[model samples]
Target: MADDRPPSGLRSLLRDDLRGESPYGAPQLAVRAALNTNENSYPVPPEVVADMLAELGETLPGLNRYPDREFTDLRSALAAYLSRGGEPIDPVQVWAGNGSNEVLLHLLQAFGGPGRRAIGFTPSYSMHAIIATTTGTAWTHGRRSTEPGRLFTLAAADVAEQLGALDPHLVFICSPNNPTGTAVGLDVIEAAYEAAPRAVVVVDEAYAEFARPGTPNALTLLAGRERLVVTRTLSKAFALAGGRLGYLAADPELVDLLRLVRMPYHLSAPSQAVARAALRHTDMMLSTVGVVKAQRDRLVAELTALGFAPVPSDANFVLFGGLADAARTWQALLDAGVLVRDVGIPHYLRVTAGTPEETTAFLDALAALGPEHHLGTEKAS
Candidate 1:
């Protein structure tokens, strides 16, 4: 019997792009050394947690009501934290969402749609491509330069050339980029902006706090640029991955445009309360930056000695390029009650720096695997 459903009347664009898409959940959690998500291993300070709980208890009276339509207080706090000297922010120049991922989506919604293109480099955070595809924006990837025996690096000239050719609507660059964990140079960002004067240039600095000494932040470049937007998250350096707080700093005019498209009461009161408490303890959060850096250097050294090709990472997680069998290595680590990310790229694995004990356990696990299982390719020069 033929099923008698009416002919679909949806737009071809929707049918073509999102016909079979499904929601995704976080990675599995097991009682192992979890180093996949780049989350801090430390717990929130007791005092901070107590303060947040107290604040939430006070706000219980309004729990039944909708949160503030505009998260003004939270935004003010975040703006102050981000400002160089705690100067006043226009407030109109601030925007918040569930996470920086959502902020990136809103930026795409503002600038990308049919016929317009969004551009990013290859092997970036996967979400950029996912969001662009779901939004019906044309997505393009620019190739990074790699001379024989050299590491992968983006060339500003090459980016300029590609931008000139594509004339995209939005350009995305992730500094201390995910998976690869390398920081993009200020010159490269400036050149990208120069190439696309009319396009919105988004610098996703989700890992900016982990950036090494002397690395330029995108915020320094946002003062005079009308089309530039910088997205940041509290998840990484602030140890607020569960708090779901993310924001964008942009030209006041641009931020106002985002408000028009953003859903009202987007941030819940509990989230706001916790984020504020975390912000008040900014010194403690900043202190983790140095600790993570030291751990990162140590992890790189240990991994290098074990004959793994760990990339020069400025972020909390590091990537290795010479895994003999990434899938097997990942499974072995998991079986031994240690878990790292298997990126599925040929011979590549990613490991987030964990606590001192977790780090030692990971090294011991690798050591048990012996040199025969080790992938000791020459380091990229």
Candidate 2:
């Protein structure tokens, strides 16, 4: 049998910090309804695909040379696209990476390291802690109330208290936080900045475009706060997950610092070309957002009606509770040709908002399962 131990029995050679760590991923399973990862289920609009292909085709001839190290034009397009959020941003203030995870890795690479620390509310983005660990930064599990009713939400006072006491060097707050879909308030972010005066505070807005009306984003607060960062992705709302474009908006000086840590010509020419093309058709790419949100809302109402407690979501997925066993329920759903995420939450499972028909597939699968799978979320709580 192949041993799972570090290759060549090199346990002693492996970094002590990385011991016992498992790489993060979701099941890439085939099913009739795949509502596991919160990916934008819609295909890119045909016209945008043509545009991407045309733009990328031009870049193909230049593969012999390194891509523009600065990625000037793509940055301009990203800034212009971000500005639609009611906040005008200069191209100098933006930087990108293969994915938001890499963008985060760059942040920790620059601002975090041995002898420093980072804090994030537990069950936020798992990668926040993962990146901190790999960078030799101490990961603090900033906790919120576990009491019933409040339900996975963070408060501003809690932010101020934990950050002030810990005095970490880097912090992350995810709006429309993953797994739970709870959107953090701006007041909490401001509190985090105030509490960690010397730290770089990141607001991860991967699902910002999916937020319902009146759910404000952190972009408006970037004006005077030099230490603040707002990270976004094309993977979710823009329906460009395969294109692998994630970016951040921050002070130009901070954007410059990332250059010190990043590899030369980090973005490939084709990557930049495709992203720029998609950015040119921002409205069309994001046209999927409304439909996804409608399905998201439908997931909330339907899950609740099915006796599971569904968290209010501003993102493209719903985390529903009241399972007798999340693992069993996940397997049962998979057996029934539907796949959902068992996010390690005891009684909860999260499902993505797919096309309306796919939504029906998931719901219908769940309805077919016996009630023994769990209790009502209200009753469970």
Candidate 3:
């Protein structure tokens, strides 16, 4: 009899964008100080977890069925949290997904695709490019006019010039940007948004909780800006990284469009319960933020004193230059059981702030490496 089994041709017909992609693993299991990923060192509070479990037990009837497709209750609670400090927001204008990464993918799907172009600042978060490429959208990089080690301070004029020329379909700006942790001024953000009349501007405030008081929030600018969207994550300051809840606050029209493409039952019932309970205890999360900020400051000072040229940061992590070979330094730190992110930007590395004990261990490891690894005098690239 002839072989009736299907051929392996399905693999060949898969999307070209996903061909060689592999999972990005964390050094969590191996490293003593797990700082490679920007996760909170603090665990979720016990009371909050208990409360969520209690709620889940009570909601067992719904567990057998699909979760609320709209996630309406979670959206309202998030809106209330965002508006708690005098900044009002409408629940109708918010949308969420498994994580901010998903939220961003939906935005790109809604606004950018094959014929559309996505523009982002270089050395920003790497995910923007990944998402653009996977969506088959042309992705372009605009160099920030700041110094080599200063990736966070982009020139609004330079960005405007690019916007005038390319007129990209989507633009992404990460405030208190990942890796660098520096914030772009709101005026610069406004300038970029104004210049891109035909494009949608995405302001990613994943680390907004770490920004200083009085810093402009994208929500504060959303009143008249229909082309702007602000994406946030509870994973950061809310200590719910494992919960994987993220949201976008935008014009109701845009929010509605995102909802159209979002997969039904995107948020899990347990995840929703956990996030809502965490939000109810927002003050506890803020207390942890205070501790992280203080530790961040102390780490910056120590790194600078050690001649590492640490970049000024307003987030839970710090980036610095002066390593001889960042990859090798990363390896050495790993050998010493300390884990950090190597940006592969010649001599730059990023270290996320952890608990006091973990931070002490990392500082001791760097201190042992000493001034020889300081900028410009180390091994050749």
What TM-score against the true fold does each predicted structure earn?
0.91, 0.96, 0.93
For residues 249-291, could you state the per-residue lDDT of candidate 2 as single tens digits?
9999999999999988999999999999999999899888999
lDDT of each: 0.83, 0.92, 0.85
Q: Cα deviation in Å at residue 173, candidate 3?
A: 0.3
Cα lDDT of model 3 by residue, 293-335, tens digit: 8888888999988878788888999998878778878888887
**lDDT over C-alpha atoms for residue 158 of model 1:** 92
- 1 or 2, greater by TM-score: 2
What are the per-residue Cα lDDT tens digits for candidate 1 across 1-381? 996554366633466566666654436677568888889888888888888899888777899999987888888888888885343455677888998988988888888978889999877887898888877899998777666444657889999999999999999998988878888898989999999988999999898888888888888788788898889899989989999989988899898888766777788888888888888888886677777778888889998987788889989989886676788788888888888887657778888887888888888887787454555532331
Q: Give the number of the best model, judged by TM-score.
A: 2
**Backbone clash pairs in model 2 (N, Cα, C under 3 Å; residues 3+ apart or in different chains), count:** 0
TM-score of 3: 0.93
Highest lDDT against the true fold, candidate: 2
Considering lDDT, which of the candidate structures 1 and 2 is the better prediction for this target?
Answer: 2
